[model samples]
Target: MTTTTDSPRWFKSSYSNNGGNCIEVAANIPGAVPVRDSKNPHGPALVFPADEWSSFVSAVRAGEFGNL
Candidate 1:
């Protein structure tokens, strides 16, 4: 896990309107990108490499995840 002295600053997409199904992401951390369920702010977060997270976002923008 990436340790930090400060808590993550999580945020969701402006397009998110799926009620409790939305996920939040915190990319302000120095070395990692963290993601978690928007409905469960206090729950565990999934951490990923910044590059990997960027790739995933690009793929999502490109519709590579299909109808997601």
Candidate 2:
């Protein structure tokens, strides 16, 4: 998992609202991205490579998950 040693400021998804079923992400973590469930801050974080994470974000922003 990525660490604060990389010094990334995690941000909750802007689409996150009162539902409380959202996720948070830390970007630019050198070679990886760290993501965690917003409701479980102390839980294990899932790590992804930078390029893969960017593609996921792009897919999300493009509404690829909307119909699914």
Candidate 3:
């Protein structure tokens, strides 16, 4: 697990409207997608397999979470 201190490039959704509840993701990391709260840049991040993250995003676009 790499730390965010390495300065992994993080980006939030362009649709994010400066809300305090958003999250940021660093997809540049090889083999992983690191996700952290946008409000807490220095906080611990949850790293997910890139493929899994893609699947999750797809599900979200597909409305799997339903009204979330």
TM-score to true structure, per model: 0.85, 0.75, 0.88
Model 3 ranges with Cα > 4 A deviation: 1-5
Write the residue-wise lDDT of candidate 1 on 1-56 in tens digits: 76472578889999998777999998789878989998888888999989999999
**TM-score, prediction 2:** 0.75
Q: Which residue pairs collide, candidate 1? A: none
TM-score of structure candidate 3 = 0.88
lDDT of 2 by residue, 1-68 (tens): 65552466778867677598888898757878989888898788898988999998799889999963
lDDT of each: 0.86, 0.80, 0.88
User: Which residue pairs clash in candidate 2?
Assistant: none
Weakest 10 consecutive residues, lDDT, candidate 2? 1-10
lDDT of 3 by residue, 1-68 (tens): 66543768999999899968999999788778999999888889999998999999999999999987
Task: Pick the TM-score winner.
Answer: 3
Ranked by lDDT from best down, the candidates are 3, 1, 2
**Higher-scoring candidate on TM-score, 1 or 2:** 1
Better of 2 and 3 by TM-score: 3
